[model samples]
Target: MKLRHAMVCSSNQNRSMEAHSLLKRQGFDVSSYGTGAHVKLPGPSLREPNVYEFGTPYKHMYDDLRRKDPELYKRNGILPMLKRNSSVKTAPQRWQENAADGCFDVVFTFEEKVFDMVIEDLNNREHKLMKSVLIINLDVKDNHEEAAIGAKLALDLCQELEAVDCWEDAIDDIVAAFEKQHKRKLLYSISFY
Candidate 1:
């Protein structure tokens, strides 16, 4: 069976988008989200972030950034990331606002704080379906290079999960092997939908 997957990060800009692009390319039934109140992108200064509502289109963000400071945005890799994001989905989605998206078999979060928020959100929702979702956190630095590497690692884990006949039965062994092989600690929990 093909497992539905989600990649989550704080802003849904760098890390989540990278994994979303890779997983979608590999033919996984995947979606990506941010666990933030609003979508934010780096601006000219640390204090001045480019913020947008959750449903704002990636194309609009791309165009706006390009118009604001093409060279700076391009140099910072924001333009390319937004362009890639536009091709994948229409806009950035917030996890809290998208409970209607239903349950994913596995939701991979790139940061611990995002994992916590996802869990908290799940806990607060009614579990009409009573379906279990595996939420895994693999701490990744929020940067282009780290996102790329984390995306590859996430794909490998998904492939491993896909190979199993019954994921719920084999998840423990799979996760243990993955941790041993990658030498990266992973935090995972099961939540109901």
Candidate 2:
């Protein structure tokens, strides 16, 4: 059976989307989600928050941000990112509220907070429903550049997991390997921002 995966981050704009793209391109069954209350971004003024709800269309958000502050959107790479994101047919999803119909074989999160949230949610489920999923958290920053690197790390780890026979039975060993690789990547890579 093919393994199903999910990638999660704060806004579902940067890290999770990047990983989703890479994993899908590699022919893995993957989905991405955000854990934020609403989609949030740096807007025209640093003080102004650009927020969109879970179901808001990416193009709409892009256009609104462009209208609000063309210069700020352009400078932050939000315009191009939104353009690409729009093609993916993704809307923001709060992890706590969006229950999975079918459990994922593995779930990758971009930060500790998201990891904790996922763990808590899984813990709340029945024991049989929780035992099959493996959650791995990679400590990547919420920036475009770091997202790109995180995608690479996620892809490598997924590919490694794919090669193993009965990976579900080897969860602990696989997670340990993932953590070691994650740490090695962080140590070798330069500063995120």
Candidate 3:
């Protein structure tokens, strides 16, 4: 059976989206979310904050940014990124705010902060189904280049896991292999970039 997965990051724009897209391309059932209070990004000016709520339509935000400061949006590549991100099934959501769906078999977080938030949400929730979900924290920075690198690492791990028939029985070994690969990838990325 294909394992259901979820990816989490500070903002749904970069890291989470990258992993989500990669996983989906590989034929896995996956979803991505943000753990922040609101979607935040660099605006036209230093003082301007591009803040968007969870339910904000991606197109709305995109159009607003385009109209507000077309040059800045294009210059930062946010326009194209937003266009790609808008195609995702769901909008940005907070881990704590969403109701427990018990759909995901594994959850991957791009940073420690999002990892903690996922754990805290799982702990505080009344649903026991969450206990069965395996949470993996991959220390990836939230940037265009880093997001792409992290997605490649995540895809490698997922492909490894996909080969195993019994996921629960093989989780420990899978995690160990993932960590080893992640470390190697991180080192190689440092040298490469």
Candidate 4:
């Protein structure tokens, strides 16, 4: 089976960026972009809390997988010619063509800006491939915050779809929540697709 497509969008690479990385590690075909696409310069606004630098570790994790996983891009010869220009590239004004091309199963927006922009754009477009898109904001707090945010985001994602009987993953978080809230693990079936 093909892996599901997931996209994450956030303003200034922070919590949302972190979630994007973790999702990719969990084996989803994921991509992340920032909401600062129109910014002409990298400045104070980005350094401020909640702002993440474009192309920084905040948005893409595991330390430059392009270099490490050369095999994945061998056919395109992309691994060897890593460009330093990406350090300052503008985030996309909208979700990229690939996502719109019907390759994605879901898209998650981390901040209000991204959700407002991307969701409204998608909702207005007439694309048969745009099946399900979710816009959600994570409630942020203190230190150890990354792990807290990551875990909760993952669990919550599994829960939301499970509530509607729409996911097939065997997440203990979702299963247990159903048992606790609905009082039955045996309530539903027909596999999540």
Candidate 5:
């Protein structure tokens, strides 16, 4: 079956967007989201993060950061990331804030915490459709390099799932094989929408 997919992370700036770009290019019906209250990007110090509201356009972030510290943002890769994000979508989206009209067939989260948040959000919503969504978590560090790696791994898993006749029936075997091949344990939970 052709599945609708969503990639989720904390801030929707790094990991999710990375996978979002890749999945969209590969022609998968995909969307991305974050569970954070505010979109946060790395700043000059660990204690200080450049924060923006969820609806703030990525282009604004890109320009704001460039104006703040062109050299630093460029060196840290935040500028490039914002540029890519702008190209993919208008702005960062908050998963919790989005009362999504439709449900995804499969949702992928880059961290266990994110997975928990997604599941919790789904549980809190009314199950009007009664459609089950497979939520999978693969722990990936919140960094540019790790995001890239995780995106590719996510794509691999998506391709594998798409190759199967019925993912719901073959999910167990597919997840097991994927774990064995990638040497990464995945946590999955099913929820209705």
Candidate 6:
């Protein structure tokens, strides 16, 4: 099966943005969005990411995170895929525009509230063709929670995307906790109707 067209949704775009880039590096077609149609960073936004002299997304994500919130990026380090070119994490306008169309094969929500919303909306749509919606809770809003959890979640999601073949499997590796990860379901818990 050709797995194409995936979307990651979060209350805020930070972690989901990172997930989108990492999934692309793993050769999966992916996009991302925020539940609230946020247009830009709230305040003290990180500037657009520039190619680190060495060209890795790690440097870009970390450096940007550090610039925006040093303490968080300090706790968890960034790891680039070596050959992958860094992308400026999702711009607010980019996600809002794409998600407005609502065309995605797999929609994974990192935020608990967003997860419920997406699932509810998808079920209400009544199309029910061949789609799966999952709620893989992660601490995406933690830039306020010492920032470390948010940074760590972003870093780990990137790591998961490196070897994952399917969206559901990638999420299965993460634990139920808001921060730590442990492989359990590995897509075994999911089945399409």
lDDT tens per residue, model 5, 1-193? 6766555555557999999899999988787888888888999998999989999999999999999999999999999999999999998888876736757888889888888888898898899999988889989888999999999998898888889888889999999999999899999988998
Name the runs in model 5 displaced over 4 angstroms. none
lDDT of 4 by residue, 1-193 (tens): 2336666655534444455556655666666565554322222244632222333331142234444454553333222212221332323323543245544444555445565666666666676543444444433332235534643565456335535544446434554664576443321212111
- Per-candidate Cα RMSD to the true structure, in Å, reads 1.4, 5.8, 6.0, 11.2, 1.2, 9.3
TM-score for each model: 0.95, 0.84, 0.84, 0.49, 0.96, 0.49
Write candidate 1's Cα lDDT for 1-193 as tens digits.
Answer: 4676555555558999899889999988788888888998999999999999999999999999999999999999999999999999999888877755567888999888888988888888888899888888988898999999999999998898889888888888988998899999899999998
In model 5, which residue pairs have backbone atoms overlapping below 3 Å?
A: none
By TM-score, the better pick of 5 and 6 is 5
Q: In candidate 4, how many clashes are counted?
A: 5
Better model by TM-score, 2 or 4? 2
What is the lDDT ranking, best to worst? 1, 5, 2, 3, 6, 4
For residues 6-79, write the lDDT of model 6, one tens digit per residue: 66666653466556665666666776666664323333335743222212234444456567766543443322
Evaluate residue 30 in candidate 4 and report its C-alpha lDDT on the 0 to 100 scale: 65
Model 6 / residue 86 / CA error / Å: 9.7
Instruction: Find the number of clashing residue pairs for candidate 5.
Output: 0
Query: Who wins the lDDT comparison?
Result: 1
- Candidate 4, which ten residues in sequence have the lowest lDDT sum? 184-193
By TM-score, is 3 or 6 better?
A: 3
What Cα-based lDDT does every candidate model obtain? 0.87, 0.71, 0.71, 0.45, 0.86, 0.47
* Clash tally, candidates in order: 0, 0, 0, 5, 0, 0
**Candidate 3 on 44-133: residue-level lDDT in tens?**
676987999987877888899999889889888888878878887556766666635545666777777677777777766676443366
Off by over 4 Å in 4: 1-3, 38-98, 139-152, 159-193
Which consecutive 10 residues in model 1 have the weakest lDDT in total?
1-10
